[model samples]
Target chain A: MTLPKTRWRRRSAARPDEILDAALTAFIEAGFDAARMDDIAARAGISKAGVYLYFGSKEALLRALIDREIAPIATLLAGFAETGGADPEGTLHLMATVAIERLSDPRFFAVPRLIIAISGRFPDIADYYRTEIVERAIAALSSLIAKGVAQGVFRPVDPVLAVRAVVGPVLFAALWRHVLRGDTDVPPARVIEGQIDLLLNGLKP
Target chain B: MTLPKTRWRRRSAARPDEILDAALTAFIEAGFDAARMDDIAARAGISKAGVYLYFGSKEALLRALIDREIAPIATLLAGFAETGGADPEGTLHLMATVAIERLSDPRFFAVPRLIIAISGRFPDIADYYRTEIVERAIAALSSLIAKGVAQGVFRPVDPVLAVRAVVGPVLFAALWRHVLRGDTDVPPARVIEGQIDLLLNGLKP
Candidate 1:
């Protein structure tokens, strides 16, 4: 006997990954405040109830999105950390290359824009970002700097401050290019190389 | 007939400076989103109508707040620019000192917070900030760096990138400490000096 087609049946059988992918696209297009559950469901070709079943609410979905996006970056850096920090310049170049490559992905820019857009209304989300994503990134960079200092490869520097200086410029450059200037074609690698060179060589007579 | 004592009369007579001072405090305390015109008027001991009489809307008040707060800073830097990059180290120390001093001011922190908060909600406000404030500051710093290099007082560097590296760390450090970390006691001067040192002397061994 053939079964009758229903929205619930379609939703129940839908993949979680497909739902998340659709939700991300919806969130990017309309922002968190404007994005509706129905839109996400529509994008996923599932029922609205199915989205709620998978991700409790819109806020939960956003949290899940952030986690899903940041996890891979953290993992990649974790792997880089295992190699130690004998070469400061090479390590920085590698990190910058990887960072630029990741940032080229649409999700990277979209996630931050989403956060900044909703940060005022949802302070907790911003707080989570600071503690989870920013602090973790800083800690990773700090450990690498400390390792480099111990090896006497890089100059003895305050690891925390040094990490801030190195990472801050790259992040702001991307922000300026993508968010402010709306110039995605500007090569992130060139900007990163210029910044790395500036950091390595002081503007001194 | 003798003049009748009225709250409206008293509020109407209040000075523009006093109203702005109160608005700044209110904006800082509750932020742009939560702050009310009535509260600002009450803080200034004026009526809400009196507050509106001077500034047409909440956004206009914010724009005025930014203008009033940053004008003095622009004036101070104007004096620095007039010196024509004679002493690079001295000029840097002076600029760093001014940044540290401004960070110490509650108004400096509050104004930016309000702007950031409002900018998230209003795209035009953010556009005004990018064009008027951020770009202008970058231009001034870039010109100073170019002059310094041409005067043979500093190393030949990409002035634009160098200025960004030199300024970004200091600005973010203040934002991190005050806004994010909420640590008022953190000495900004020491941090600024350290950043200046880092910029003058590269991190290479």
Candidate 2:
């Protein structure tokens, strides 16, 4: 009983993730509009029916892919926002480090790249992404910055704009590395450190 | 003689720009590979043969489009770097203001957004863009930063990383407003001011 139940649970839990991975590969290789359910199913080593059983449509698969990949990061940011009130500066440093590390990975960056590509054609997809992921992340970061301002550790700045400054560099680094395929002699960690330093200390002596 | 020469020059010079604008619209509507020369020619109110007479192929058209749109911005950055050594801080402020104002326009932002979309499949195009535009811009900005540091105006920092810090937020704002279609209640000018403030003045109270 124990062996059978353990095996069943593992297989059931992993199937959705496997399908999502296959969907992402298919979407990347073929644009979202052109990617076929059959290709995704073949990539997953499953039947098309099986793919449909898991995700009702291609759009659903994309939404799920975004959720699976981005939801954890959002959760982590929320956690920081909740508990890092005492040391907003330190927390921001940690957040930047973690974000750069994760966003540097091509796999993690792919969904956002895909979103950027198709957003012009599919406004709904863009809106969905903004509401589900970006707004949440920005809100969490803004709350943390607000906390810092409240505690008098940081200068009085609009948290909304501050969130953009904090996030813009990290997003740019990811775009530079992945989308542009630029050569990176400087390690991402160092890039993150440099950005955070400039962000916190500025260039003025 | 003067009328004929002036008319001829205007028709010839403006034809290329008109064709390039049509090409951009066609490319945006259809992904680069799928876009048709006929569509571009038709959009430009010319025959396909006319388009071929001017630009040989879709790839050539893309290259020309990039050059027509982006070369001026690169030139502007170089100009600033050359004459802006005396007042680096003021120049940076002016640069950011100009960059944000230009980049905020959807038409101006279109090329970079298009590049990001297709760069995965077209590494050569990406390379061409980086060498022709991004590298040149970064070099110019780095020289300005180095000049500032030499003048004892700015803190000692690696100019390359510093360039990233300076360019990243402006790029991000463009992406957010255009690619993501995020609603912007605050004017782009204010956003640029806030980012510049954060960069020049540390968050330390």
Candidate 3:
């Protein structure tokens, strides 16, 4: 029973993640329009039928990438809420750190890159990305800023713009990594923290 | 003499510009790899020979786009130098304004988009954009920030990161306009101005 249970747990944990890793490579190499599931399965060391067992189609694979890679955005926001009341600014700082850390991770960077790369050709992909990921993250950051303004801890500023100000540099860093990566001397963390520092100091009344 | 000279001047001015516009459309539709010179020439209402007269090859056409479209970047820096001594902060503010205006122009928007879109597949294009445009702009912004910090106009900060902090948001906004068009409620001007305002305020001692 113990041996069988171990085998089952390992299989469940590894299979889906392996397929996703393969999918990122395929998508980046050939793009969404040209990436094939059969090729993805081959790269993942699985049969086409096995890939289908996990993801119904190429679209589902993309959605799962969003769900799995980007799920951190909502989770981080919710987690911060429990302790957010203790210190409004602290909550923002933590969120900034998390955003830079998560966004700059190469494993998850593909999702945003894929969305931006195809954005010009496919309006629907951009819309879905905004609805599923970007807008939700913006809403969470906006609410955090609004709370600060309401409590009189931070100066009155446009929360939406402030959220954009905070998040934009890190987002830009993430995209720039894939675009002009070797050209930049500034490390990802430095770019994120430097941008956040200036913005945070400016936020103080 | 006047009639012949006028006819020649109009043809010379219009033909190159028309070819560049058609090149932009072709690049966006098919990317750098698949885009054909013949197709671009057809779109521009010219013969392939006409295009080759102005541009030697496909690579030369792209280089011409960079020269014609992105040349403003360096020129703007030179324009700011005359008044930079009188007002360093204002210099940056004006540059920010110019950046937003220039980048948002649809004709120019496609240049950066084409650069970013194929950055992974074509490293040289990204390098060309970074070296030719980004580095020059950063140098101008960095010098301005250094002068401000030295002259007691701004709080001391890492000048490189400061320049990046200033440029990153507006650049992001320009890119965002194309990627998430029709979805944003905040006007483009507001997004760029708000982010700039926060950073400017933060720069104060």
Candidate 4:
């Protein structure tokens, strides 16, 4: 009974993740409107039926991909919270660094582009993006800003607005570099550092 | 002779402009892929062949739309340049104010959204957008930053990064208010002022 249970657990864990990985690549390249399930299965070296067994449909597959990728970002925010928000700059720096690092990882970068690429065709996906990813991120950063303000380390700024100020430029730059421009030579770390500095001192004040 | 000349001039100018306006609306709503020439012609209250007589094809119509709508943004930048780079903050403030004011004009708002929506499907359009709109804006902002740095008004920040820092938040907020969130209650001017203030002062700096 123990041997059978161990084998079942091991088999289920690896195959679904593999299918998701293939699905992400296919979705990014061909877009949701054009991507075929058969291609995803072929890329994953599995049957079309097998891919469906993991995710009931392509939409479900996208949801799963989003869920898998976003979990780590949530975890990172949680870890930042646990530190009592002692260093706002440090926390922000870490967030930027992690985001930049993860963007280089093929699985992570494909998710947002996949969302943007399909968003017009399926408006529901855009709503999912706002609720699942964008709102969560804003909430986490808002809390961090509130913590810093309470500690008297930060100014009395609207946390939501502050979070936007802190993260907006970095995210936009990353989007331009990685997705729009496809220029890999520009180091994300340098861009993050410059952005963080601008945020810290601001344009004038 | 005067009567015949006046009739021809009125026929050429008014009809084409009306057709362009209708095409802009239909393109914005339906996007390039889904927009039909017949629908545009019907919207313009002209024959389908008449629409072709002016623009030749759907692609040609889009090209004409881009020229009519986006050329003004370039003209605005050129006007700003002609004023001389005296005050960075003042110039930027003026630009923001004018941009927000122009949001009341549906053509100003809808045309860009149309381009963003359709650019992914048509690579040529995307290339034109990158080359014509985005690159020009970046160059203009970069020039402004360089001028500011030279005059000892702004810190000697990286011009590219500074432009991103200044523009990204404002653009995101505007897009959210107008396109995504549709919260027109909060005036665009107020949002622009807050963003400008944020840029001038760092969160921690």
Q: Say which candidate scores most in DockQ.
A: 2
Ranking by TM-score: 2, 3, 1, 4
Residue B201, candidate 4: Cα error in Å is: 2.0
**Colliding residue pairs in candidate 3:** none
| lDDT tens readout by residue for model 4, B80-99 | 75475998878877776676
lDDT of each: 0.71, 0.82, 0.74, 0.70
- Candidate 3, superposed: residue stretches over 4 Å from native: A1-17, A30-38, A46-60, A81-83, A182-192, A203-205, B1-16, B29-38, B46-60, B182-187, B203-205
Q: TM-score of every model?
A: 0.80, 0.89, 0.81, 0.79
Q: What is every candidate's C-alpha DockQ against the true complex, given to 2 decimals? A: 0.34, 0.53, 0.31, 0.30
Q: Pick the candidate with the highest TM-score.
A: 2
Per-residue alpha-carbon lDDT of candidate 2 for residues A1-205, written as tens digits (9 for 90 to 100): 4455442233556788889999988877766766789998888877798888888988889889888898789889888888888999999988888888899888788888888877776688889888888888888889999999989988999887788787888887888887778887888888888887888888888
Candidate 3 Cα lDDT to native: 0.74
Tens digits of per-residue lDDT for model 3, B1-205: 4455442233666888899889988877766655788999999877888888887888777878988888777667756854585688677778888788787787787777766656666688778877787778777888888888878777777786677677777766775677766355676666667776778665223
lDDT of 1 by residue, B1-205 (tens): 9665763454444467788888888876666656789999888877898777788998888788777887567657656755747776777678767866786676786765555444435667667666766666666677788888888877888887787686667666755654545334547777777777778787777
What global local distance difference test value does model 1 have?
A: 0.71
List of chain B TM-scores, one per candidate: 0.86, 0.88, 0.82, 0.86
Q: Which stretches of candidate 1 lie over 4 Å from their true place?
A: A1-61, A100-107, A110-127, A182-186, B1-5, B10-52, B104-107, B113-121, B182-186
Model 4: docking quality category: acceptable
lDDT of 1 by residue, A1-205 (tens): 8665753454354567778888888876656655678989888877798787788888888888888887668667656755756665687777767776676666776675566545545678778876877677777777887887888877898877787688667666755654455345557787778888877777776
* Per-residue lDDT of model 3, residues A1-205, tens digit only: 4455442233656899999989988877776666788899989877788899888878778778878778767667756844686677778778877877776676677777766666766677677777767777777878888888888876788887677677767766665666776445766656667676777665223
CAPRI tier for the interface of model 3 = acceptable
CAPRI classification of candidate 2: medium
lDDT at A78, model 1: 54
